[model samples]
Target: MIAASDADKWKKALLEWDVTSLEEHPSSDGVCVCGQTGLLWMYTITNDANGAELFPIGSSCVNHFGRTDLNRRVDVFHKLALVQATANAGKPVEMTTEFFSRAALKFLFEEGAFTPDSYNYGDGVNDYEFLLKMFGKRDKSTITSRQGYKIRKLVTSKIIPFVLADPRVR
Candidate 1:
């Protein structure tokens, strides 16, 4: 298992590499799918006051239907990717739908963050929801099926940008 110190080190490195716009924006406290809680980072993507995305900092793994090692690595890689994606965009990108749903999954599976599961848990929650809980957001109901699908699209859209812009992963 990766030590907390090691994880912290990885987080720090990822922050240095990705988090570009460090200016403080409005944020809220929420739970991740994993059941952890902290200040969730948020960003406004629209000129209108209503268009904003809330991203929980760390999420859980309850929904991950893969091997332990893969799940852990994917979790770690995603933490790094989130910081990088935010930095690259210079604002809070949609964490719930965009970041976690798409890019994070690819990074997790492609990077061998987790191994495929032989059996399905068939739980109502998904890996993303699990991540949300892990980060401390308790309300799994808040994440909807549609939102999950959107997140997948968002991640697929941003893959090229993320890989092209960030040389570390390449």
Candidate 2:
């Protein structure tokens, strides 16, 4: 379903560009730089040499570069979308261990959303420690309602706003 443009101008425009950031469309109505339509995610690519930025490019076009950094960014974007969706749904957001995998938590951690002193439940234990403990429990039945509430609040208050304002994936 993905194809590159055959025109020389398009080929030239595609080269030497690196993805800077991505924007998610509420619907699949976006068009790619290569003329691909029906894209839900649009990537912005910039040429540092010329300071030229092309926007609304689809993920397939980005994948054409085969860059690991770009791929990782795409993955982060998907995870961000999931978090956003839950936050948008309103109160009582569920932070299931399976839903928030180790990678997703690590991404949040790396994004500076989680720190040693961020979560202090008056028990001398930080949020990072509590989250890691919850994440390790594979048994869904072991996760308490109170723990789920804390995780939900964390996602709603911290992660959602951070991702919405500035993802910093680039």
Candidate 3:
């Protein structure tokens, strides 16, 4: 993280920015504009008025800028990162039930992950219905092996890529 020489200027700039995208780094090498280093999660914030952008900002710095909305967004990305890490390590991500809340799944759906083009479970269950069913299962033990496999596949193939795609800055 590079130290901001003009703290007031940077803070004012941050107030005009809103989080536009989020990304996860495999290693803790991310640097925030605020001079904080070792960030594993990076956020892209864009200033709407001037169309300027700052990326790879630490979540704490974003919160310190009073953007709690980014904090909530971070939680969703953090959960996805866990599944992404597990999948990248060749582990089954399906057995985990604690990572995704209904809202997170809904967010992904809204982002076009579970749409007809992206996912077709082929079991006659629509994406929204599938998500509802998955969320309804209260425990990992209740999630069948098939369900688990589907969950892992969905996270790896659909949700993660779509959510982490680079946002088109205006």
Model 2: per-residue lDDT, tens digit, 1-170?
11232224755545556667777777889999689999888778777556667788788877877776766666666666666656667644455642465666666777677533435644323665677788787786888889888876766776667766665331
- lDDT (Cα, 0-100) at 44 in candidate 3: 81
lDDT of each: 0.39, 0.65, 0.64
Question: How many backbone clashes can be found in candidate 3?
Answer: 2
Full ranking by TM-score: 2, 3, 1
Model 2 TM: 0.66
lDDT of 1: 0.39
Per residue, candidate 1 scores C-alpha lDDT tens digits across 1-170 of: 11212234543422221211111223546454345655343211111222222233232322232335434444445455565656567754445543454445545445433322322144323443444443344465677787556544434444335543544431
**For candidate 2, which ten residues in a row score worst on lDDT?**
1-10
Q: Report clashes for each candidate as comma-separated counts.
A: 31, 0, 2
Give each model a TM-score.
0.22, 0.66, 0.65
TM-score of 1: 0.22
What stretches of model 1 exceed 4 Å from their correct place?
A: 1-78, 81-136, 159-161
The CA lDDT at 75 in model 3 is 64
